[model samples]
Target: MSRLEVVCPAGTPAALEAAVAAGADSVYFGFRDGTNARNFPGLNFSREEAEEAIAHCHRHGVRAMVAVNSYPQAGRAELWQRAVADAHALGADAVILADLGLARWARSRFPHLRLHLSVQASAANPEAIAYWTERAGIRRVVLPRLFSMEDIRTLVPALPVESEVFVFGGLCVMAEGRCMLSSYVTGRSPNLDGVCSPAEWVRYGREGPMLTVRLGDVLIDRIPPGDKAGYPTLCKGCYRVRGRAMRPFEEPASLDLLSRLPELMAVGVRAIKIEGRQRGRAYVERVVRAVRGAAEQAARGRPLDAPDLRTLMEGGRATEGALARGWR
Candidate 1:
């Protein structure tokens, strides 16, 4: 079996170093602006930082991919274009993109820079994947977090491009780049604005032995005493639906597929991506090391032995995340 490339996240320059040192094959991150999805405060790399990051990755013989993945808003298309230009100028190994127009522009201008279809494009099937691959000359496509093992087995072989799947980190309840629940609560779009439940509007406080969390005016979650409270994301929030209190979307568990690395490899997956560009360097180091070790073992057809990473996961819990079955 071909070895599965362990593509890791690089939220900051420090995180980039952590990932490369931890044996990542490639480290992907976004710009510190509206041009990429994880455009939160204090996260992502500035142009200067990105240059250093690419240089550091190359020194370690690791690929550095820049995420210019956010959709271009009306009249602000140039902003996205400039991000692509900057990525090429800074010597990124590949540009991960979602918008068709931006992809076409990148291919036209920088003919040699590799192109990857971001998960934000939500291309799960063969036709959609083929359309983007043919149109943008895409080298790889990050599959949406909606494919089952059966689905992946059939789809990856038929596609003309290499396939990447999320193995660890956050699991979106909705199809990528299409969630409106966060936008409903906070008038901002994660796909367009690049901030999901933007940190500015998230509020947390103690209320009668319960921790109450609110995104804008909507109270998304109320954690009882002694319960581990998670970050306030509107979709993963506990809501009162049908007169019953339940997490209408998904629970506060992260996607953990360390045990299924061989299954992913057997399914003809070319790469496995770890999410959480908003995570820190320590997170990058631990995850990359653990995954790198496991991926190496899987490639050699050896029994994979890795430490339990539950404490590092979201809400101290983890799920297989649609790889074994459907998310519902």
Candidate 2:
């Protein structure tokens, strides 16, 4: 069996270099614009930076994948179109895309450039995956974080294209590309603006010994003095229902699937992706190194002991997410 390829994140030039040095087979990043998800201030690459980063990845024998995964706004399709062209010009190994029209445009403009369906596309079922592969010639699809191991084991053999799964990093409770909770609070859509709970709208305050977190005037959560405060994203926030405060959607936790590396490899997963483009170089390096070590061990048929990444987890908590049984 082939060793599973490790795909890592790169929000900045430093993060890209760190991922390369840390044993990532590929690094995915986006331009500093709304054309890709994880669009945030001081994150992603400029055109010149992307060119240089791609060259650096090539020098280190690592594939550089560009993300043009956001839906184009009406009368502003040119921005996304330009991103697709730029990725090909920069010699990107593949362009990860979500928008249907943009994918068609990419195929028409650069037929030889490899195309990958971003998880934002949310092509979970075989028919949906086949549509993208057959119609747009997408070579691979990043499976959403919603599937269990059994679902993946069955889905992979049925699909005609290669499969990539998120094995570690932040967990999203909602379906990728389809979430609207952030827009409801911050008026920024992740699908179009590539931002969810954008930092600009986030506010923090203190009331005596309690810390209050808000997203656009709407209180997300309140932490007691001794408790840790998490980023105030609408979905991950605790809410009051039936006169009691609880997290109805999901908690602010990271996903770490190191223990399941062997099972993922056994299911014929081609690549394992680690999510966190908005994080720093230290995050990219540590995650890539850990995942790389686990992948190697899985390939050697060794016992897959879960790595200790508690400090690296969001709010210092980790979960198997939907990959485990009874997630729903």
Candidate 3:
């Protein structure tokens, strides 16, 4: 079996170094602006930092991918274009992009720079993937979080380019780049501003023994004093459905797929991406190390000794996500 590439996250410079030291095949990160997703406070690299980070990765024989993945705002396309140009100038191994116009511009202006289709592009089928590969020379496509293993088995061989899937980390229930729930609650858009339920608008309060979390003025969840509280992303919030308060959309849980590494490899997946650029260096190091070992074992046709990552998961809970059988 071909060895699967472990594409890890690097929200900060420290995280990038940690990932490389922990044996990541490649590291993906974004700039400290609205041009890419995960545009959060105290996260992502500045241009100079990106240059240094790419150089550091190359020195360690690791590939660096810059995420210019957010859609450009109307009349502010230059910011996204500049980010793509900057990634090329910094010698990024690839630029993960979602915008059609920006992809075209990058292909035309910097033909040598490899282009990747970010999950934000929501191209899960062969037809869409083929279009991007044929038109813009996309080298790889990060599949959406919803595809099952069987779906991947069928889709991988038919694709024109390499396929990457999110094997671990936080899971998005809604189709990528299409969710506007956070935008409705907060003015920020994950697609345009590269932030969803941005930190500035998130607030916490206490009501006697219960802890309340709000995204702007809307209450998302209320955790009992001893219960673990989760970040207040609108979709993961508890809401009233059919007169009963429940989590109708999705419960707060991280995605864990280490147990399925062999299946992923058997199906011809080229890379496994970990999501969490907003996380810290410790998280990056531990995750990369565990996944590296798992991928090596899978490549060797051995049983994967998957690490128990419950504590590292969101709310100390994890799911196999859409990989679960009977998932529609």
Candidate 4:
């Protein structure tokens, strides 16, 4: 099996330093504006910060990727255009993108710059991936959460570009770049505004013994005092159906694929991505360091005796998610 690249997330400068020090093969981040999907308060980089980030990563012999992944509003293409240009100018190893217009623009503007198809594009299969690769000159693709280990084993050999899969952190239930659930209540789209539950619109209050979280006026989740409040986003929210309360999308558990590292290498994945740009340096350090060692173990064809890292995840629980299909 080939050595799998350990791609990690870096939301801030401190986290970027931590990830690079922890042995990340690559560190991905976004601009402070709505150009990237993880556009929460105090996350992402300014142009000056991006310059320093790329330089620091390059010093450690690690690649740096900039995410300009969110869809641009119809008339406002310049902001996204500038982000793509700056990523290339700052010597990013790749610029991750979703919008067709933005992809087209990036390729035409910088012919030699490497382009990565974002998970937001949801280009899972060969046919969909072919369209982006042909039209926008995509060199690598971040696969969505829809594929299982079996599906990935079957799919990677047929794709035209390098395959990158999410190996750890948060999970998304909806098809990327298509969800409107957040906008229905907060009037801010993650696809456009780049925040799922905008922090300004998020409210936390007590409903007797239960703690209630709402995005604007729409209630997202109710937490019994000691429980973890998870993400305060709609994807993991529990609601009543026919008087029975349940989480219709997915249960409150973070994605943990550490044990499957050897399986991923056997399937020929070029890179493994970690999905937590909204997290802090401690989380980045712990997950990246653990995953780096696990990848090395897997590369040697040795069975992985890895930590589950459940304490660092949302809800302090872990699941393989769709990797095992109907998992309990």
In TM-score terms, candidate 3 sits at 0.98
lDDT of each: 0.89, 0.91, 0.91, 0.90
Candidate 3 lDDT over 5-81, as tens digits, reads 99999999999999999999999999999999899989999999999999999999999999999999999999999
The residue pairs found clashing in candidate 4 are none
When summed lDDT is taken over every stretch of 10 residues in candidate 4, the lowest stretch is 319-328
For candidate 4, write residues 59-99 as lDDT tens digits: 99999999999999988989999999999999999999998
Instruction: Predict model 2's lDDT versus the native.
Output: 0.91
Give TM-scores for every candidate, taking all chains together and pairing residue i with residue i: 0.97, 0.98, 0.98, 0.97
List where candidate 3 sits over 4 angstroms from the true fold: none
Instruction: Tell me how far the alpha carbon of residue 136 in candidate 4 is from the true structure, in angstroms, after superposition.
Output: 1.2
- Candidate 1, 49-74: lDDT as tens digits: 99999998898899999999989999
lDDT of 3 at 106: 96
Comparison by TM-score, 2 against 4, better one: 2
**How many collisions between residues are there in candidate 3?**
0
**Model 1, residue pairs in steric clash:** none
Error of 4 at 71 (Å): 0.5
Full-model lDDT, candidate 3: 0.91
